[model samples]
Target chain A: MDLLLEIAQQVINGLVIGGIYTLMALGMTMIFGILDQTNFAHGELYMLGAYAAFFFSMVLGIPYLVSVCLAILVGVLLGLMYEWLIFRPVRGKDPLNAVIASLGASIFIWNAALLVFGGAPREIPTPFLGEKVNLLGVSLNVQRLLALAVTIGIILALYWWIGKSRLGRAMRATAQNREVAALMGIKIGRVAELVFATGGALAALGGALVGPIFLLQPSMGLLAVGKAFIVVIVGGMGSVLGAIYTGFGLGVLESLTVGFLSSAYRDVISFAILILVLWVRPQGLFGRTGERGG
Target chain B: MKTLPYRNLWKWVGTGLLLLIVPVLVRDPYYLHLINMSGLSILLAASLNLITGFLGELNLGHAAFYGVGAYASALLTMRLHLPFLLTLPVASLLAAFSGALIAYPCLRLKGPYFAIATFGYGEIVRLILHNWDTLTNGPLGLRGIPGPAGFINSKVEYYYFILTIVALSLLAIWRLLHSQLGRTFWAVRQDSVVLAEMIGINSTRVKVLAFMVAAYFAGVAGSLYAHYLRFISPDTFSFLESSTALAMVIVGGLGTFWGPVLGAILFTWLPELLRSVSEYRMIFYGLLLWGSITFLPQGISGFLESRIRKNCTTGVARDAHS
Candidate 1:
């Protein structure tokens, strides 16, 4: 049957680029499971929330659903100015000094967006960029079924706001034990500034839903923060549905290794499956080998 | 305990004769190419301050073992012609055999899972030196090379041949940080389970001998930066050159022996004195690496060694009350 409908249209274009790498590895595995601090400028705040939804739908023309809620309110006001000017004065210092001050605020917001948006790349326009559909006989691409229906409606509204809110049970009691979530009363630095402003508003709604379909630049947040750190190290660093099932199983195994190997070894097969899953499961894939310290 | 005191051996032979007569009184081949690019960024910020400031370990892919010792001394001196002082000890033994083969399965993971498994083995060695390009010519990198000729072709003989290989790798990392195996690698960085119960000392063989002596002085500063900028590429060892060699070992203060030479001479002359804010030079190098980790976290040589240990404990308590 036409090679099972061309391997089900290359597994629905590798589950719509693994539903935009599971909405940019669900805001980098919920700010590395409540601020263990990777945020190496969380892919330059998902390239400044796709240039704040491309300057709100191509320079204030608006309505691409109100420029994806104004690129998640400018990625929650640049994740509350990166937790009020860099992680509330280096919270509990020496997590390698907040990973070298979030890699010097991701090389100062990618060289201040290469000095106010210049290192080229741009393009936004979406409303299903030159649509397409078909179905059984296959064909696809209505912007990869609207990026798999906005990544299954933002992974079922971040699994009902992280399993029914109360600020998601004080961000799962401050990621299990921030001094037993500050001795139960919670307020562990306002649940790490509401998990770094809901992980910089879900990495600026995954750079305003993968900026139309990949263009915008300023070094496109270093290969979407190195494939969202190989989908939060093969989905484990404090799980969030194992970074949405290992960011759609590493975006359908890097779109079946760029359709049968060699899109210049598709980011060397996702950095050799992130150094062979940190040499065979260094507590990833839903971690918990004694939640090895932050 | 006070043995080696001929006035501290004439202050270590007058600081190795003022680092061999201050590059022959400033010969100025653009200040000996900014003192041979601050002796290859003080041998990559003193071997990334011996794996993140003397083994507290947070190696976010130390410029992938200084770009695997500058592509193994630029492919053994451009396709096996060798002899740049035998391709600097075969690019510091192929960057200490790829830092003891990625520190024997990543020092069996610790903190930030060994800094995201050495930032995924420095982006899988810069994506196999950018798609192997039939042995790295991929990103059109490796270029001319050949420099360190007879007496290293001038610029005051390659600034006294990279200041005699950065004073013999800073006197073999100050004799492996003043050995008794450098106090069991500073008691496995202060307290690896009380230096494995008061001194049995293994702490994973002193963190794989401080990650093979900081990947053998970052493969002799990537074989003197592939014989002084013959040319290299993989965007000159990115991860923003391992976050400017961990911001010159945390703004030059971490574990102090002249804090990665005053944080590799003020983060390589503060991007050449903010090259006239050439387009907000990386937003003032990200506001001087977030204002030197938010207000000098013990940097400027640990704020001048805690004001010279508070003026030598108030001059030995006013010379014991006179």
Candidate 2:
């Protein structure tokens, strides 16, 4: 009974964490879809988002909700700056150039954070801190449930925006064929910037939501980005829905591995699965066949 | 004309003598240490250039093979108490085998897919190093690794040891580039489909061979690193180390001979130069990386080559007009 209960708890925890992974992967996939460049610094943006939230709540004495909002806004602004300053000049160059540039940006941001905030982990006090609810004889943290609800709501909102809005249509059009979209009177450049900002915002939201659960630290971006890349690869680089599914699946798998197996091998199992997925379907689970490049 | 080969031999002898005379003239152990490190890094950067620059494969997890080589050599020497010289070849072979293993599954991937897959492979190696306590001793890391005996106990001796390895590896790589197999690698890089149709060459075979050769030299460097540092840990072979190696190749001018060497020297000493601005060293490093990619995408060596080519063309045009 105890084993079953532990397994159940692990699954719930994994699902909640998977929600954040889904958001991170979605951001990366969206950027890949539009720009065809893998933003190596996406993880750093996520880290910055967490820091933004931490600063707002801890330093500025804002409410948790206000902090989350501020984090998203800050993420969007930084994303815009990235597009304007670094990516704009190297727009048509080889994808490798962009990859290297993003790596530079990642190092720059991470080190800046380290210098400014120091290497110590910062805590974000949850709105529902110290509260636990029992479900099916298993004690579940209320903060985790809140994270799940927020993630689901955001995913639904994103789906509706992408499916029904004119801006979303333009973004999709640009992603599918930039030249054709431009010919059809779409401002492809503006759309790209918007997509990048949106992606950054989503990543920031993920970071802020998970800040309470995991301490906010500059180096925290490395692990999050590593796992997020796996999700992006497994879900296919350009598929939004694919990222969500694979993110959740990977989360559950990792949780189960940690629960049943050793915690040390958590990353090992995740990467093994990524390799297997790539071996079987190199295009990723939701990647369109023959969409070459990044 | 008859004495041309002899003249070339004499020139080579002069260069070798100059290299030997350099350390004695400097007489600074610190500079000698830097030279030794540069030689090892040259081997690493040059080997990495084979894949990233020549073959046009972006492998982000290169240090994993390096780590593999280090651990393999470290275990052989530490556990079996074998002679250090024998362990170098064993480590290189093991690393090559593992590189082949990784390449088999990952070669099918193209572009960023291959890059991401290799990244995963690197993480897996690090995780194993962290978790496999029975073999790696976990985070405690292996210590008391023996240094080279006799002359190598001194910094100048160690410089010779590394310089010899660097010279041998550079020669082997140069020869490989000039061989029929080297031509095939270039052909594959230009266009795999064209090479496949015209020459009936299996691009996969060429790629795997290039990857393995690169891994072999990296293993050699890794073994040297383990013995030089006299310590082995997972922290030493992080993604940051791999990225820096890749940066050296890119900033040196990919696919150009001597570019990586120049890049290795500049980048290796860059941090040392910025030692005064220690607080913002990494930030400056990041900005420099960005500036290099954004502005001088072809790298310093490439920029200089283009300038020389332009000047020569202009001079020839002027002469013709006159």
Candidate 3:
């Protein structure tokens, strides 16, 4: 009975963190799918999101919810900047060039952030921290609950926007074949801008949402980006649904590991799962195999 | 032809004499230490160049092999009381085996996927090094790692030792590049799987061999580093270090023989030069990386090569007119 309660509690905790992973992975996969470029600097946007929210709320004394929106706005702007500055230059070049460029951008931003924000970790105080709500024999922290709720809402909205919207159709077309989409009059640049904006927004929101849960640090993005990459890979690169499923699934698995085993081994589990997935099914769980040209 | 051979002999002798005299002229222990580190960095950058530059595969887990070599050498010397010479080979072999281990599974992946896989492998290695308390001392790092005894004790001696190893390794790499195997590496990098197979070459075996060679040199560098620094730590071999190695290769010039050597020396010295503002060094490094890739795609060596070629052509044209 006790073990069941513990497992249930772990699962709940996992889902909340999983929600944040989903948000980051969504942006990453979208960039991969549409732009056909990996954004190694994606984590910096997430870090900036947390920092933006912290600045707006803690430093400037703004409401938490409003700060989150502002943070998202910053994310969108940063995303557009990424499209122009980082991804644009390497477009149509060797995919590795983009990787190197983005890596440079990532290193640049993270270190610059360290100089600007200082190396010390900071936290955003929230009203949700002290409150807890009981749900089905388990008590959940309100902040965590809020994060989970917002995650679901965003996921649903993203699903709708990508599925039914005209712009989303353009994005889908662009992802399918950039040359054909351009031939059909879909502006590749516009689609790229939108993809980067959405990716930035999603990653920033993830940062803003999880700011209260985790300590915000300049180097926080390094680990988050690694995990996001794991999520992206396991979910099958460029697959939105894959990112979502793997995000939550990895979160749960990680939470269980932390609960049952040691926190030290939590990341080991994710990476192990990544290697295993690559070994057994290189295409990922949902990704189609041998679909890409070398 | 006889004159050409004599000229080449003179060049070799001149360069060798210059290298030997450098320790005598600059007697500063600090500068000597920097020179030694430059040699190790050259080894690392050159080894990484083999995979990223020659093989056209980005192995982000490269520093893991370096770390593996370091820890293996440190432990072997400290615990098993094995000689430095023996530990060096054994550790490098272990790293080569690890390279093969990582390369086998990652055979199917290419480009970003391969990079991501290697990144994961690196993190796993780092995590294990950090967590495995009994073996690695769990982040506290191994201290007082015995230096190669008997023949070498002073910094100058260490410099000469590293100089010899680096020159030999570079010679081996140069020889390999001129061989048929080297041409195959270029072919593999061009289209890799399809083109190599079309030409009756086994791409898989070639890739594995390339990875082994790269890892072996990286391992050698790591061994030298462990003994020279007389310490070993997991943090020393992180993703950051791997990127730094990658930067050395890229800033030097990808797929060029002399590029990494120039890059390694420049980078090794650049950090020390920027020690006053050490905090901002990484920022500068980042900007340099971005700027170089964007503006100077050919890197310093490539740029220099082009200029030299242009000058030679003009000179030849002028001579013809005369």
Candidate 3, DockQ score (0 to 1) = 0.75
Ranking by lDDT: 3, 2, 1
Question: For candidate 2, what is the lDDT?
Answer: 0.84
Task: List lDDT for all candidates, in order.
Answer: 0.77, 0.84, 0.88
Model 1 Cα lDDT, one tens digit per residue, B86-184: 888878888877888888787777766687778778888887897788888878878887776777677777777788878878767766776666656
- The local lDDT score (0 to 100) that residue A125 gets in candidate 3 is 88
Question: Stretches of candidate 2 above 4 Å error?
Answer: A291-294, B1-14, B190-192, B195-197, B314-322
Looking at model 1 chain B, report the run of 10 residues with the lowest lDDT sum.
B313-322
| lDDT by residue (tens digit), candidate 3, A1-294 | 778888999998999988888899999889888877988889999999999999999999999999999999999999999999999988998888878888888999999999999999999989898899887778889999899999989998998899889999999888888999999999999999999999999999999999999999999888999888889889888888888899999999999999999999999989998898888888878789634211
**TM-scores of the first chain across all predictions?**
0.36, 0.96, 0.97
Q: Candidate 2 chain A, which ten residues in sequence have the lowest lDDT sum? A: A285-294
TM-score of 2: 0.95
lDDT of 3: 0.88
| Model 2 complex DockQ against the native | 0.74
Worst 10 residues of 3 chain A by lDDT: A285-294
Candidate 1: give the clashing pairs: B179-B182
Cα lDDT tens digits for candidate 1, A103-198:
788888898888888888888887786888898789887876776887788788878987887888778777767787888798877877777777
Best DockQ among the predictions, by candidate number: 3
